[model samples]
Target: MNRTLHRVGAMCAAHPWRTLTAWIIALVAAVVLGGAVGGTPRDDYDVPGTASQAGTELLRERFPGLSGTEARVVVHNPAGGQLDPALLDRVVDALRAVDQVGVAGPAQPSADGDTAIIDVRYTVPVTDLGADAMDQVRAATGAARDAGLQVEYAGQVPEGEPTEGGLGELVGVLVALVILIIAFGSVLAAGLPIVAALVGLGIGSSGILLLAAVTQVSTTSPSAAAMVGLGVGIDYALLLVTRHVEGLRAGLAPQAAAARATATAGRSVLVAGATVLLSLLGLILSGLAAYRTYGFATAIVVATAVAAAVTLVPALCAVCGRRIVRRGRLDVTEPQRPPLTARWAARVGRRPAVWAVLALAVLLLLGAPALTMRTWPQDAGSQPTENTVRRAYDLIAAEFGPGAYAPLVVAVDLAKVPQDSVPALQDRIAAVPGVATVSEPLLSPDATAAVLTVQLEFSPQDERSGELVDQLRAETLPAGAEITGVTAVFVDIADLLAERLWLVVGVVVGLSLLLLTVVFRSILVPVKAALVNLLSVAAAYGVLTMVFQWGWGGQLLGVDHPVPVSTWVPLLLFAVLFGLSMDYEVFLLSRIREEWLATGDPFQSVVRGLAATARTITAAALIMVVVFAGFMTNADIVTKMIGVGLATAVALDATIVRMVLVPASMMLFGRANWWLPGWLDRLLPHLGRRGSAELDDPADAAPATEETASLEPAASR
Candidate 1:
């Protein structure tokens, strides 16, 4: 694999313009092809096989007009008097003027006589409509307020807030620019990673857009791809570029340095990317379309990044190798010296147990909050105060009740029950523990089904609301009643995910362990890696729960109030975090493993491996943190949560897992760290050649004495 990668890199270096031109052509093709093939992203929250989904399907088949998106205009007589008949007509007239909307019902007056609701059905699905269509609706509705009525609109209102909500990529790039400039002290060298990331992301995102034609890719998926792609993309390119610089210092020619760098670091990047994509692919085990699409989209972007890091980056490096030198003609004239990281590793190795225990304690403390973590789907109530959704929610809560905004639909199969028994069943349903009120049941055309709207006292995402759903579902009601509605659907979603959460975790953990075992060719090494990754991921979850759920410093992340973690967040976070956390684990251990093999001494290998890779791991992790953290600027709370969660995980993984737990654990294991059962060794395929090559040990590599470490030449001439 190393030789193959080196050959490809060498070819690209030899024909830099050809490589760059190929990438440019690919980028343009992606953009043009994506626009031509792709459709709008789907954000459906329906969970198949759930009662709510069943009810929705029944409704769509039976009541097409009622099932589509409806805009509800709630207007009140500010004078506390009867509404003028002319005023209602004017509002209806305004709604009728809109191209996408047709009146679903005449004005339905409330018991107070001051408040009324007018329903208008949209011609197209709400998800398909753009901001312009919504703007027209808003304008038409806003005119009713001019007639001295307090008008508020609810239901689907142009959610097209640009799927690329957070400009996190720009901020991430800026942060990377600073970190790279500091790390390399060369502006040209610092920019290469960013250039590669943007190019890769641009093409990858376009590809996701193209995917919308075949599958329901959520609008957020592209932004998610960008977020993951940028952080890892920059780090991947940085790894190769850094290696290239070292190659130049080793007295290799410009083309050979680029080729060598690609051969070495490019191999690691490929492994890291494969692991990430594999982990992401674990989302398919969820059996949810959204998860599947999100995972697949992100994997595509990561693949593109890896491709660029191995090919385009090498070409760029070759094109500018001589200019990369600050001093004339790169040369390592003086003997090299061990960096601060090497010294730190040596010091930590002296008392590995203490550092390990301390790191473990800290991780456990942070992860404790995860034990109490809860999940829910955010609704209009969770929106910011300035948002239209929030305003409509508040108005409904004030006029009717919070539950009115998210009424539970109790769909009963009348075919299984007698007609005369309906009244008695309705009474029993109304008497259910959490039922605040029950609307008059609407019978189907054949009277084979009935839909009853049950309003509760609590909001959709409220803990009490979830309890109410459980209470109703548990009830042995007649007519084979099934609970369905916005709230009920979310409850079902949470229930479904919770039921399978352990299963998904098992799959991801199993795959990661297997992959690590294959890559490192050791049983214990992979086990240790999985255990530490679990700790880091848990710690990240705990901190996010404290901040977002507990509302500790939640405002700093743009969320003004506390929120339960979104129903899908845990599963998605686990898949992503497990893969990402493994990146640092792989980065550090692969180097250490290389050292261990070279020196045949576990203790020195641990010290030297930590010393050699700490700076690189830290720099990579820092770039990721900045990129993920920048996503907090997005308006969507869910996106903000994802950003904060990922950032926190990377930070913990790099410092605790890489710096402390890893070295300490390896120290305790001694030579056992490389143990593979004789039978298992034969069972595992020898994925040879592309194996790790980071070595400075005299035994297996160039003798990296303190005097010559800084000036060490590329191994094996």
Candidate 2:
């Protein structure tokens, strides 16, 4: 890895303009290809082979008209407190004329006659509803407004989202830029990292768009990539730049400094990026389309960041060259001998057990609530009142039964049961406890299946709703019928996820452990890394449950009611957080191991390694936390939950896990931290950059030998 990075660095530095021109061409080509062939984004939560999935499939195949996205156009008179019947008729007429939405059920006025709700259905999925649908929606709402009534839209496409733009991302980047400037104290030095990161991510975005041609990609994929890519991308470059600056101060020539930095920090980037990629790619084991899609997209972006960091960053370093050095910065030659990070590391080494215990205590306190965390699908009920979807949800729950938001369909196999008993089965289902309303039976074209829609007393997001599903499936299902719907499918999905999540996690964790064990050639290091990351993930979940589910700070976040944690959140969090946290471990441990190998001293090595990487790691963590936190401002509830969860996990992992626990654990472990049995060492692939460098140039080992000798600590000497 080191030799490869050095070669890449040497080539880029030798011909910087060629490297720059190649990157520019690649970026432009990617964008052009992406725009030409990208698939349109869609929102789908289909859990295949589940009862609900079977029912929905049947509906789509047999009755396409009834299977599209549903919307409700609601009108209310605020001043008179009475819906004008004539005005509602006019509004309905305008809506009926709209090409996008087809009125489903008749206009049903509230019992009080003050408000009326019209059921409208779209022929496409909610995510597929384009500008034409919006224009039609505007026309319908305009009609209601003309009649001096309150108008809002709900269901298929939400309202009050004027532009669904990435304003939060822009704000985060701006803040991150400010942070970088302060951290480096040189505009050009700071800007190089950002530029490198953005250029890489730009190509990544285009790549994702092009991938849309071959498969379904969620609209959220780009934003998610942006959030993660920005932080990792910049950090990868920043570490290289930091090392290069140190190299220059060590009296290495310009090109030599860049090459050496690439040989060191660049190797760390490759390993870290590879781990993140593998961990994420392993999510394909989930066998779910959405998870697999997100996993693939993220993996590709991370790969892009790694490639650019190894190649483009070096070229850019050469391009900026001496211009990046300022009078008080490089010329002033700030001493790296006794950085504050090393001092903190020294304190930690003095009482390794004490610091380790304290960090564990904090992790336990934060992670405690995760044991009781409950996950379900989020509905509009949890949204703020100002949101059109929430308003519509509240009105339905108020005027109709709470279950109106989610009705379960009981699909009966009439062939399996006596066909004559269909009516009797419907009657029995309606008589079931907690069933508020049951629709008349609808027979399949062959009369072999009968479907009945049942509205329960509880909303789909309610725990009681899950209980209702369990009751019907276990106790109340009439001989031939199985309940299925949006509510039922989600319940099944949540249950199945709960059942299989451990397997997926085990696969990823096991894979990561094996990879790290081989890379680091130590059993305890991988074990310790996994344990700390797990606790960090747990604490992140606890924070999510507190804010989104436990209702600790709901109001401040603009949510009126506590939402159930999205069922897939924990699984997604586990994969992403584990990989990302491990990236930090890779960075820190690689340096520490490098030092240990050089100095043949464990205690001093830990201190020097910690001091060396701490500032860059902290800055990296800050950027990641802020970027993720910014995503919480999005109106999408799932995105916000993930945003908060990831931000907390990264922050905890970076500080508590990286700074306190890891160093302390290594300090306590001493020489044993690097121990590997002879047989195991022989079996494992050699991961040291020095070995790879020598292999690359059998006759060129002298230069690397000289470089290593120059890097020896003065204290050790």
Candidate 3:
């Protein structure tokens, strides 16, 4: 590890221009390639088992007469539900005149005889109702209202508009920039990392776009790539620049300081990047194409960020070397070490066991709410109340059947049984509970397959919908030999996700353990790290349940009522939070291991290590929390869940896990913390000699007999 760092550092010093030019060329190539192969934006629920995809397939295969599903429409009334006959005629005329509309109807009087509904459907595919489709729907609805009728537009297509916008990304970037500016207190220093982060994001996004041209990557790949890349890239650059500034404060010359910063901080970045990549790659075991694509894209982005951090940032610094230091500070004699970190180390050493238990108890309490977590299947219209589409949808649902907008597709095989058999099949399906109506089946052109449209009594977002799906898949479909359609696809996806969830978990846990083991050179270290990471994850899950599922703080957070968390949220949290939580574990333990190797006294090492790193870890955690919290401002439920989940994880990991639990456990375990079986130690590859020993006394370990005393932050730093 040291040798590689030194070599990279030396190359940077000798050929700064070459390093800078090489990265620029790669960046340009990535952009050009991306432009030639643009990416597709996908809805949040674009996964295979999602209702939209399944319903569309069934419509095409079994219900050919049905042009497409009618997910939503807008009805306009000049004075609420009452409309003049002439104006109503104009509204009907305008609605009928829309070339793309498949269905159009005037308000049908309700039992109360006060309100009316105007139903409309699009000629285009229902699956295409993202931002562009929603815009068109809005335009059509506006035209109807302008014709002098009261208009209330409600449907799934319009409901998803707020989420599809780039609101979350914008918030995250703005928050991060503000925080960085404050942290650095200089425009150049803050802007440098932002520039590096943007370069990483551009490359990562372009790479995903280019890859999508060949492979069927998820439409959500670009957004996920951009979000992940920005956070990680900025983080990597921060570590490097912080180290460089510290070196300057230590009175090292420009070239020498840059070399030391690269050799030390650069290696840490490499290890961190590798760990994050491996953890993300573990998502392939999910067996869901969506997750697989996400895993692949995220891994590519993290790798690119790491590369840019070490190569691009270093090269830039080399060119602008002395300017990085504050003016007239060439001979400043600031301390060479970190003092705030040393204070935390000494505090942890004082009562490790007491703090450890307290921290663990807090996490367990926070995680208690997870037991009540309910799963909500994908619904196109699940957004906050303040959203226009959701409000419009509620208005529509109030007038019509809850399931008036979203319907299911049922398919029957005609070749095996004959067209007459489909009626009986449809009758049987209609008899099932929750089936409000079943349209007659339409046979395919070849007469091999037919489809029926089934509208349920409940809304598509209701839990009853999933129950109905289960009944169709397990009871209805199996009753006949040759029946398959969108419902079947959804059932298949659900089964696949359930069966492979554990495999995904196992892969992530196993790979993460392996990497930690390799990095720390101890079996116990990896096990402890994994346990703490899981605890942090569980706590985050509990918080998610409370906020999203139980409606705690939902209104304040811009969430409307309580909704089941997305199925993908847990898997995403597991992968992302685990990698992020591991960051602190790695940072804290690496320093501890360094002290232990130098002092050879477990007790003293714990004190020294905590004192050396606490402040930096805390600062980093704060920055992450601020950036992640910004995402919560978005009205989208899924994005809000992710934002809250990440912020909670970082906060808990840093304060409870890093500051309290880790110190307490390490101190309580004492010598056992470093003890590894001879065979296992030999089996794992060592990262390198401890940095503390390397920087201090290389030939001698600190005396074990030295009185075990708390080292002050001043002494340690």
Candidate 4:
């Protein structure tokens, strides 16, 4: 692996323009082709094997019109005056005349007569709707707006102009650039990673657009993909750049430094990237189309990042040459006592247990809220307050009730039941405790099936709504009746995720454990790493629960009230966070193992390894945290949850887990940290031998003299 990476790096460095031109061409082609042919992402809430899915499929097959998109045109008289009945009729007629609107129900006035809602059903599904769908709706409602009524569209209406969500990513990159300039003290050095990351992210985002063209991709996929891609892209390049700088300070030529850095840090990058991809595979087990798309979308960006890290970054490094190294007035020429991190490591080493206990206490305390965590799928109600859909939701919730925003659809097969009993069934359903109103059944064209729209007394995100779904399924609904629609689908999704969350966690953790054990040839290290990573993930979940669920500090993130954590967050967080945490682990542990093999002193190895890798890990982790946190500015609540969750996990993992727990635990365990049972060692492939040889190369080693040591931080050594 080392030799292969070294050769690849050398080739890129030797012919810099060729490598760079290839990436440029790829990026341009991806952007242009994707824009011309790529598909728009649309939410498909169909979860196979769930009752809701079955009912939705039945609707498509039988009552096709009802299965298509539906929206509500909400008109409110904010002045508390009654709407003109003549104007309301004109509004209904305008909606009916709009293109693709199959049905526009009569305006239903509120009890107070201050607001009215007209239900509009489109002939086409959401995916089939044209780009001007929302524009047409807006145009149709203009008359109502002109008459002094507040007009808002809700319930399956197309989203308006895309949010300025990319701004968050831009800010994250700018911040990372500043940090890099300060750390490397060279503008060129600072710019390399940023450039590579941008190119990679551009390509990856275009790839997502293309992917959306072929299959269902969630609206949330792009934001999630960008968050992960930007962080790792810069992080991977930063690792190589740091290593290349170390080689330069040791008197190696630019080409040699790039090759050596590629061989060493490049290998760790591959391991880290592979682990992340592998962990994403666990999402396939989620049995949800949205999650699978999210996983694949994230994988594309990560792959591109890794490719740019190894090829584009090295080419840029070679082109820059000695200029990449910090020199002139900024250079330190004399001994500064041992690096601050090394000194701190030594201090912790002297009393390992105390540090470990303190770290654990912090993690455990942060994680306590997870015990009471609740999750529900977010709806338009969670949208930013300024959004039209949210405005519609609030108006309806205020006048009619929150439940009016999300009505459930019941699909029933008339062939499986007596036609005369349909009215009796509706009566029973309406009599159910939580039932607010049940519409009369509308039969299919052939009269083989019927559809009923049921409105509950509680909002979609409320726990009572989900409970009613279960009760209707198990107690009230007939054998052939299945509950579905957006609200029911969300309820089923919550239940599905609850059942499979642990399974995905187990798969990700088990696979990662096996991979780490094989890579490091250590039993205890993999086990310890998994445990600490889990702690960090749990702490992140607790924080998410607090902010989003318990409403602690919710207003700061733009949420007006508490909401259940998005149902898929815990599962996705576990898969992504566990793998990301391993990035720093691999970088740190690999160096420690190299030192251990060379000197056979566990204590010194831990200290040197932590000292050598701490700064890089800190910088990389901070970049990741900021990148993730920046997504809070996104208009999507689910995206905000993911961003905050990822940011919190990375922060805790880097500081509490990596800095305190890992070092202290290694020190306390001593030789056990490297102990692998003989049988297991024999069973595992010898993956580290060549990498170990590469690290041990005298030519690649850091300067041994005190003066050089002082000039360079332990990271360079």
Top candidate when judged by TM-score against the true structure: 4
Q: List the RMSD of every prediction in angstroms.
A: 4.0, 3.8, 6.1, 3.0
| Off by more than 4 A, model 1 | 70-85, 93-103, 107-136, 139-142, 145-153, 156-164, 167-169, 328-337, 689-717
Candidate 4 Cα outliers beyond 4 Å, as residue runs: 97-100, 159-162, 329-336, 688-692, 695-717
Instruction: Mark the regions of model 2 whose C-alpha exceeds 4 Å error after superposition.
Output: 80-103, 122-134, 156-166, 332-337, 444-448, 690-717
Whole-model Cα lDDT of every candidate shown, in order: 0.78, 0.77, 0.67, 0.86
Among these predicted structures, which one has the highest lDDT?
A: 4
* lDDT of each residue in 497-611, candidate 2, tens digit only: 8876888779888888888888888889999998898899889988988888889997776777778888868877787888889889988998888788778788999999898
Residue range 538-586, candidate 4, lDDT tens digits? 9999999999989999898899988888887888888888889999889
lDDT of 1 by residue, 195-273 (tens): 9988999899888988877777765777777789888899899888888887777655668778887877787788788
Residue 342, candidate 4: C-alpha displacement in angstroms: 1.1
Report lDDT (Cα) of residue 383, candidate 2: 62
Q: What lDDT does candidate 4 reach at residue 421?
A: 88
Candidate 1 RMSD to the correct structure: 4.0
Between candidates 1 and 4, the one scoring higher on TM-score is: 4
| Residue pairs with backbone overlap in model 2 | none
TM-score of 3: 0.84
Stretches off by above 4 angstroms in model 3 are 21-25, 43-71, 81-145, 148-188, 216-220, 327-341, 385-392, 416-418, 445-448, 475-478, 481-495, 690-717
At residue 351, candidate 1 shows an lDDT of: 90
